[model samples]
Target: MMDEPNPPVWPDSVIIVHDTEDADTMKQKLEPTQDSWNAEHNTFTCDYHFSDRRYAVLFTPGIYRNVDLEVGYYVQVAGLGVTPNHVQFKGDGKGPHVPSLNRHIHKNSGTCLDTFWRSGENFSCANDMVWAVSQASPLRRVHCQKDLYLHDKDAYASGGHIANAVVDGHTHFGGQQQYLSRNVHFGKGASGGAWSMVYVGCGDNAPPNSATNTTITKTRVRVEKPYIAVYDDDKTKFQLRIPLVNDGTTDNLPQVTGDNEESRDFRHVKVATASESTRAIQKALDEGKDVVLTPGIYYLDQSLDVHKDNQVVLGLGLATLVSPVGSPCIRVAPGTAGVRIAGVMLEAPAVDPAKRKSTESHWSLLEYGCEGQTQADDPKNPGALFDIFCRVGGGGDADKRHWINIDSMVRIHSSHVIGDNLWLWRADHAELNPGESPNCPNVSPVFYQTEKDEYNVDTGIVVTGDNVTIYGLAVEHTSKHQTIWKGENGAVYFYQCEFPYDVDTDFGKAGYRGYFIGNSVKAHSLNSPGIYSNFRNATVQVETAIQHPDSPEIEVVNPFTVHLDNNGIIASVINGRGPAAQKQGVPSRV
Candidate 1:
């Protein structure tokens, strides 16, 4: 028999709470002050007087009745149980029972939960679950018996990541950039009511169809209702991969159809070493078989080209492709359809220690489509990427140095490309050195900061093709425009972006925007969005959230700005505030 995995050790920074305590005692322990009082003795409230500390609250198993809690930034609430349902938070109320009433609402605006559950009546709207979270804080391993609401009307909520969850009732993701993965159920009924899973924008008057850019992957529906619905205006902005299928049972781990077919469909080619990777992959492509890359770092002196149609390049755990200093990593030829690249990390070349301030020489790490391909609009055939992670720097001894100084991380020149769970990061958080002298020798803490005349990456994604769809696009800390969409009819669902944090005098002082839509573009869409910019030292500010002159139907739920110091300290924050739509010549909306 196999041994059960040991429970995760709670960090020392976590606060341990138990259900054995009375309501009053528990409230005091959570708030630690009377400045934010629990007026009804049921809701634990924390006001502005509360300290801004990153905290994790671990709850022992038990039911705490009639409890509603409020928290602020960088707080994580988790249940200490073998499974998510082992711990319960139940309340007495159902829908419309106002002030001092029956509903249990965890009115957390800027917080996170590892697992949040409530038990009472499964069908009652009164048993609603609500929270407002950001990208830095994600909800993991959560199972809620009640309907989940991202944000109430009053709070500005940006969407975060949700994984391995089960919701018995409807889930309303009304924030920006919400990504759902490996979820069991969402919405219970087929009717167009509160039981239907809906995504909407945050404006008070925004219609249910105002929600944009929400992505769902590897999720199933429990009931026979509309599995997923977007706002009338947001049809193209939502990307659905592995559609929510019903397996005719309540099994959380149901045997999904085609679950094992991916392995059989592709001809698995295992490359033993980095030296043989490029040649092996090319041979597989030539043989009209899909290539499977096992776990290892594959160094490429030249670009690995995919020319055939319906070719899939799959990778196992931690399989990475590293590019040389001045070469393209991977290229997809034009007119190629249904090409998939999944489960891999792409790394740009490491920065040379001797030329710390020199410019990088690559054009792009990954380029899709040939330069002169006919830009035809074809939805029937497309290129796709699943669970792809890309990094530009911070892979070696010294942290924060720009490894790949390219014009774009991903440049798409072809149409109808779909991306799921795409994360392009210019590493901001890492240890300078680990082992050697004290911690490490010759380590630089602020390598992300640009020196005079040093080369830097310009953008995360530059889309020149039409009808390109991305489910979860997260780009952080690029030098200039984070994402620039010039393509026609491009749809982006669930975009999570963060501006460079360690910008100082060494970094140049201007022209950085979270997203820049090209002026010539006519139709582009984005939904379920979160864009955060934290400026500490440099005067460079984003030109505008959206720069497209021909106003696209873009919906952003929460956009934030923070001012911090060079030492990574927050001085002030303007949360849930985005640029004016009218300034970009788009229709005025929040």
Candidate 2:
């Protein structure tokens, strides 16, 4: 019999920072050129906000000194060990000195309002930390020695989700508008928030639902996101480990499927770059090779099919997949089980209708299964999508004629799928081209013109699958219902949504709901959902934020709605259960 060959080495972009490295060695590896290596002067940096590069920095299991890390756009930093305790960061003497996220350039000078697309996982920090970020960012399985601030100095921020983590000190929300903390151990509990703050399956010390906070003591079922870990004895070997589903257990430690015994070897993993075509990548997936997409943008003419069970598609440094020809970026086949997609962004690029293609717009950015549904493989072993962001706009130039629109951002046709930390946005605002906006210069106008309704998406998510579970989901600026669920046995832990800013009074009154569960559904669980509306285009009053039949099997908890500006009003939180949110800063809860 022939011996199996070793896989190819990793690319130059995947840098493994060792514990013994000094400043010079780090700079030599990270900063090939000053122009290319965009970072702030202090610590390990990647501060270029608009740069196109992607990077993944992995730290070996050990201690480190004088290394204050600062994460920036398109960067992912993680420990190579099995758990958070495998990698420890020594403090800078005064306080806990964990790696700080990229500083925000808007509002307050040094806040983290605009920090996005960076992640920290499976690591321990010695001192106090600040992670002020918005959507598309996640912190998982991290141990913080001191208090964690979600925002800096009360600056306006809209962050994000924290899961399966331990914070020894208080987790302060500060000026953050909304956030979710799931299955976490908050040592001193939590405080602060401008609009909504949710806690689900948290420690006993966590606060309960009140006038401002929304809390759920337990969840029905949850499967933590799968991750990559290195061997303790041989760090060269890597494996993708899928966790076991939790039966309402709130423990911070993740339970793997087989005590870490069952995992896929790195030799079978394919490291793909942006230069590779979609066909080549699809072929690799079809051949049962787990793929790692390095930091770059991939343009796909058709969907990248995920057909194999237990296959992993991991993206480092915000790997982006764009569909420019009105097709889905990725599609999972029917009855596939244990397929994981993590740390990836799916985008629908703008295309002119006259560009020799079908006049129809994009159907969806991502589809879990084909249009014809099938029974899921195993109820306990479902497919997973974590830290995935989907967008319908923001890719094309500022020309209105070329803007591409999508009907829906995500469509789930497979049963028993799990998702965490998803931000599906229709892009209320996008970066404008130089000639489009003279006054604002780089930023887009507040909203698109009313006549350009063809550029906006209709819905953010549509679920036709049964037994689906989602934790920490956000959908924004969709013209119709932000989320529509027509399946049974569905569970949503935390959902945040904003109505279309361009909707008029007549449309807002009769057009949409923030969350719509079809009357045919029998069993569902939804908790801590927040819906808001600004309606900058016209004064509008919505009838309800959520609409669902009052069935005994359906459970709704801590649903709330907010009117962000004076132009909009939410008449009831859900099914006429609460008072209207008429005031700008007030929230109506049920």
Candidate 3:
């Protein structure tokens, strides 16, 4: 056996299991009388619950056989390995078969328990290990040779976040608001009953709220057959973006898509300057051709309207589209479908920081589906955005810095708009020289620092359209809500957000949340499997993480007092021991 790396210094609450002897020793430490009793078989079970206590179970690298482990509130089960496959759990049991000695049969309905099973290196399991766990309990980095069921066969499960793992058999999620990220592969099974890599809400009496909100990001499928096959319900609030390529090569297995070129095709355009570039782009769009902008700075006096369907506007090598004062850079007309905007940087007109008291508002750099009434029929082909970067500041002069004070960086009114790797930034640090005409003006450096809130942009993204999906969205330092989703059935994969560090009092003492889901509408979902935020001011830290109720699996690191509002209920507090809290970081407030 490979020597195990030095174990992490766990908190006093964690239980370390090194061998079979350690498992027995720890069982006594938790209260032997509390052990589960199986009256049907008249046998004593090994399932132990710490009740209100919060703890973690760390297993060293080894092969553990027939160990039926169930955790309770604030309990974490982790293996010490470089990847998940290092620690192996083997048994002869299959399906819902639990060892007679120490097994806890999973129930379908009850108060959801918050538990976690993860690995540092690689973890693998031979039998169907996790047969009974709720949405609160997550299993991570476990390669299962046999099927690894999440919830009971008959009952509907709730919420969980599974990351970086693979299962040879079908992996079922009979719950709602579940997130699967990073290389989760499902094996290709027989073509008969439920032959899908990932199964969502597949129970007969599944809850009405179950299986509606699910997100799969950067995941892969090993089978040649169709990856996800939904049954018994409409996969309405679902998002599948940036999937790893499944090339038909035995050696390659699951090949990751190389550069942006491999993902889509585009017609390359090299322009000497900004003049007539708009007309040239319009002509190309009119012909139903995708466009690729070569490396250059292009200025747009008027918005480049995308009226044609299935058009792609891709940029190469930091290609920039700059808008003049009070003009939007790009606009996607109504009824346009399959429109893609990628690898481009958008800049709004700069404003003098010295004029901080002005009530004038700036325009958004990009607007999509903002025209006409909402379509009742779902869009046949949705638009997509990949690696789009946007900035608001340009000019120099710390005191008189040039900035963009727009209502929002991006506005979406269309349905089924998917985004992968989007960054909407308000430049905190200046770049261009002062008094440089349009880009910069002579201003005092002190004014820039003292009037930081005055120079900041209002919001990052405002969505009014339905079925919009975003994968990696990072919006930093906006004055109001950094991202506001007024639309219904929206999905987000991973969001990295930070509140403005420089804001003093323009947005009240509570500051603002990184994202806000409108309370007027229901059925909007956000699966921020990995979300990180930090605030500068102490008073500004206490803001809601998200407004919607169905949002699940938000991992916040080193955050100042923040609240997670799921639907209308206050689901959890940042760094709290509730279902949303991380087990490793700062101690839970609960």
Candidate 4:
């Protein structure tokens, strides 16, 4: 909460501070710079991370007498026009309230996030912590969310869209920064200045999605700081304190099947509360029979580890096997080989106990997380395991939102294709301590070790062995991107596949990620740069920026900020940043 009083007017503001007064002089008198290290390249691999605590960033520091903001509340930049990148704003000029305008993409690549501050364009849609977003008009500016040069949340974005920003500070006299229909030029030494979007102005409104506004033909408008009285005096600024919902008892854990037989035929397989479902699955494997699951809710309180080779686990397409979103639904131990998984929609819940009520996504399936034995301490498990594919994650219980988790695979055919499915939750393995109260409820007691460690923390699907092949598979999420944990190496191959959402599918929480073994494959939905990597393409249609597909409620805004890293898809790298020649370069633009 900002307690500063609104002044008659805001004189000037600068996001980043510098010693020089004139930008042209600063440009002319500066030292030649090193190659610009695009943050996307690093951020893509850096895993999507969000600050638990609400935070705000200001390049230049300031004094405060009655500022009531907390650690999360940030200061602002002074000297509006000079330090940030140069931005071009367009306004309708008719009045304070104007019709909306059209939007366009930046053809050239220079309007990067970091450079935005220096560009004199305060359309900080990419990094919210640095500056603020506002809507300007003849009367005043409002602090509403709008697309701009830089995002206020400060995460890596796929395009140079400066529209998805909002005003964070006191509202003044600015509005959404509308861009020219034609590609405009943005010069260096002009990154963090304010700009305006047609018909849009500052307010507490949320950011809108990309749309067409054929009604207005304005050229541009410049952004300005709101009056000091615009400071928020009533609200509170706190970190995002929501925790993973936990189930007090591990009673919901699945019961393994390999240990029994009579239950295999589905006769006594069990129902919604039965614990023998796991035993039945195992019993079917022992008898070498395809275990047919009745189209009802089957409960196997713990993870259902498929240990039998050449086993088939079948489920009705409409039937659902609900698990707490983000919780491991089906797990394959390193001991299981020659596995064929398919036709089931598995989703973890935000609250484990709220199984039926939780609509979060699941981490679906994978061959295993051995990384073909290269990253695994046991060489026998190295890419040597034989695992197949499936038409899983597409089949949901009552809702279309589904999730699945798989590790390394031996040979994945279209059978394990993961076909078509709509997943809304994330495979987020994030959680609070076990001793603490459940972040949400019914969430698992398993602690999330996703802190870029050596432990096996892969969430979506981790495969670490050899001979991994993915053919004609489409993976995606409207809520968030999923991670495919590819450990130390890649015997991994993708053929005619699509990876579109590079901005959301990954959360580079780990150090290792081998996207491919065979260059013949294609991934279109590359979440953000590297992702937190979902997809688009020949086979799959993708939507949304970085987010948790299994998280239930889809974030409908223009990606305020996204967090990635499916520790599952990315495995451990034997060599940091790849071996030789593959040094650190953009794999494909992400």
Candidate 5:
């Protein structure tokens, strides 16, 4: 068996700097990223730093006792999953909703509990995490340059106050501090965690209190940094290389339509009998015609393989291409480059929430007779051995049904785009599959080895386009899901989008990103590395966590470097772990 990853070990190191004197002004808050949803526990707070303007990592209850603890504690873990402390909501489709997890008020909310990381001492954060406005309580009164705000999910995320927020007219945090994207939210066990290679920037064009305008000025800044590297030998965590972006660029982006819409015949197309739009679209492709979709639902499922060059499939002005519920929805495999898939509802089916297990409640096992390996050697979270429970033949169908095997959904974890937009509705398979896709039941944690030559009905969407722009979309409820966007595809711009019930954390092992880049189970950039481009002004919500096969365990596997403003939650970056030890495993540095 592969050895578990060792925790990082380093003399507690701290970086300190101080800068003062700046003028700043604030702009009107235009929109909210998130609206209404279920409520959860776990208190999360962020502190900004200004010395060098770096974002400090998140601090959890695990590290609360050691609040003044220094940074740079070496850690080795067996199955550690990462997450954004909290995120803002930004779902499009015209509406207002409430924030989940009684955030603004802690009166009724109990103590917070996170199952992922175990903290020994307080690791400090003077700068990394970003702050956001709770929907119920939008107005925040800041009195200091670097102040503290509270975001309690149970309180509708309302009520904003600046606890210690005034130093100068210009209000901002230090560079070394950590921040979270305002457009995402975390599940129950995920508030106050730390991650690496993520980016956090101050509000665009916002100035310090000193300045009259809150726009980007002379000293306005954000930060991006990497954490520990996962070692393959005995899973030793190590350091990684950080490539600097050269600033001497001058290449104009290629137009989406390529100088002229390349007239090419569309191949392998089908349409709904109820709508002639499909036939019209098919006709355009047959004659190398460019098909533009009006805002309408064209119900049809056909394998979309564009072998010809210069294919432009534009769904203009709220144009949505809905995925078929029962059958495999849409299959897109672009043979050439510059394949555009914009403004469409790409999704599978969702099992009725009422029919399924309570999303707010964790699965309980009373079958004490069964014995097996477990995430908690402690009895706080008890289950039959098989229920912590092991099942013959990999948990089989029983384990995966409720879980919605993320087999095929929308997978865009492949390319990069400057402008990326997606709107979707998610549904589950005829049956639920709990341990199927989330990596919870995965023993070794490997990608699906199934050959594409053999058609799998559930495959979703995979993307790798750059300079992508997305706007006005609502995506939710999928099973055996794939992804909205998948790999190394960089520079995405999303406007008003959502991810409600479109996920599973599974074992917290196999990576499940609503918007993730493909970085198999290898978390090393030096020996084996993963890559990402960038995303700006995006929104995500309700991507709940599932049973991780390596849960309660910790591992420092290869982590995907997600550098963004507002993104990702529930599950953060996960390290590697082993079957032998997954319960309450603390991370130790090598």
Candidate 6:
């Protein structure tokens, strides 16, 4: 038997709070006054759009009454309980409404549009909850007893995702351009979707099947990210919760403690703080430690290499990794097995002009294993990437830079890997002005400089691994193909993509494909994939939304493409097969 390891001594930034005598007291403990709270909670409310600080606020298993938890930028609020029901926010008639959890309302706009990089998981709200967020933010394993509103006001939201939760009331998607809900139970059902809405393996009042509102009755397999939870009986002991594989089932509870080895083995766990350097982090990984990154941005001077099996690198509060010199931030060594990376953002920041060659561009931000290093399939312990996001620009000084150089966001070369809730994006615009627009002007906007300027990302994801599975994936605004699949027997549950909007006349007539499968691949499958285009700079047409070999083994179900605006047209769905969706308000399918 493995020796028992010591419990993790969490950093000061991670706040652990228990039930108090009153809700007001608990709220005060969670967030003190605005000035002091910025230091204690790391809650940078003033820097709502971008901040380097990260924080994780954990609630111990208990019932709290009439407390409205306002989650701020880069803050993660989670419940430390065996199940979500154990931590309840109830209405005790001390306030106007039931206990609610909401995003920090921006002081200028009073909207949730820019509420990004924050998350809430494993908790229950007695009544209404507002989570008006865009990309890179996720809500998982949450139970909402009443209404769930997606928007706080009239501001527009780009996209969002929700998975593994139960909602007894209606979910209102107001002003959200798109959304994805997987493995959820909706008792009262969903109300609105502006562009696209997809439901996979959901139960109770499922949306009527349509091309726009796509619904998949069953999912083949789903493995959730491992989470940290306090022991229900002994609060002092923290156990790692490994989720069970969901085979089209509503709920497949994980194995109880004493039966799961991981629950007891913390010997290899290493809690990492943002103050440490990349050398320190690499040293911990070299010692075969699973590093837990606290809330903060890591500036990697060198790649953090992971070369072992079952090694986990978990991040809290949207912990970001930035490559300042145009190099990869994280790289899994060749033939490495079962390296799990979750809740992290890989960002390609502006490279210094002196440090970068004029003709050079970085290949990838995060790489899973090396190309052509084949190994036997490890289905039981596949390399898993959950809630992993990649970005080219749109935060910090990234928007002010004239050039951004990243060829691809992620490259997966290890066979039999699973990716869930992966979003690879190249920002099309910069942050808006904070003022209510009564006097403030639009400050910075991204513009194409020259032909050699790597303004936007070339691609989002490049997959060379066989038997790779992805769920709830979104790739947007790439200069080339959004996703390139080269291996055999790959499957995608739900895919949302948007082609580059700035394909100008100087660019050739040959447009980019959204999902491109190599001709050498024998088998692949896609379910409910949507590609949209909005060529605002020039009138252009893409030859195909998806390009794949037409074979019986290669199955594509319910694939559609739509022209969002500006005379952008996609001629075909896959291999010159489906109708085109041009002219506003029209959708075409294959």
Best by lDDT: 2
How well does model 3 score by local distance difference test? 0.47
Residues 1-590 of candidate 6: C-alpha lDDT, one tens digit per residue: 23234567777778777765565666666553111134433333334454466788777888877766667667778887767777788874221111111223333333344456677888888877877777767888888888888765565576788887878899888777778887777879887876567787786466877765778776666677767777745565666666644444554322222233355345556777777889988888888877778777888888889888777888877788986465678888867777778988889877655666766654798888777676537776677888988878765443345556678999988887888899887876454334313111231121222222435678999989888998778998888889999989999887889887667643326546899999898899888788888777676777789988777899887888877777657888878888887767466787
What order do candidates take by lDDT, descending? 2, 6, 1, 3, 4, 5
- TM-score of every prediction relative to native: 0.56, 0.89, 0.49, 0.27, 0.31, 0.85
Which 10 residues in a row give candidate 6 its minimum summed lDDT?
94-103
Worst 10 residues of 5 by lDDT: 383-392
Worst 10 residues of 1 by lDDT: 223-232
Report clash pairs, candidate 6: none
Residue-level lDDT of model 2, residues 1-590, one tens digit each, is: 12112333666667787777886796576443122222453332223444566777888778866565556666777887777877887757321122333222333234354456778787888877777677777888888878888776755577588888888999888878889888888899899886778887786878867866778777666767667777746466677666766666554343312353356666677778888888888888988988888778898867888899888898887889986566788888888998888889888777655673566554788889876667565876788889989876653456652366668989888888888889997766555455564333343232233323745778889999998889888998887889999988999987899887767887675758999999899889997789988787677888889999879999988788888874868888888779998878677787
Please give the CA lDDT of all the candidate structures. 0.49, 0.74, 0.47, 0.24, 0.23, 0.72
For residues 1-590, write the lDDT of model 1, one tens digit per residue.
Answer: 12212221223344556667887887766663112344565533323211222344456555666655544333435554434554567776222111111112434332222111111111112367654443333344456666676544334333344433556666555533344333334545111211112221111211234323222332222211100011123221111112222331344441222132222211133222344657766766666655545445678767878887766675532356886556567788888876777656677776555664456443777888866677434565567776566766653544434443656688889987777556777765433244523221122221223332223566888899987877557787777778988888777656667677656633323545677778787777665444555454454444344445545354333333332222322112112134332221122223
List, residue by residue over 200-287, the lDDT tens digit for candidate 4.
2211131222231111211122111111111123211111110111121321111111111112222222211122465655554455
Which candidate wins on TM-score? 2
Per-residue CA lDDT of model 5 for 297-401, tens digit only, reads 355544333333333443321223433333233322322333333223332223343555444221110111111212112111111000000000111143233
Alpha-carbon error at 288 in model 2, in Å?
1.4
Stretches of candidate 5 exceeding 4 Å from the true structure: 1-248, 251-274, 301-305, 324-333, 349-406, 412-419, 422-590
| Model 4 segments more than 4 A misplaced | 1-278, 286-288, 324-327, 333-335, 352-459, 473-590
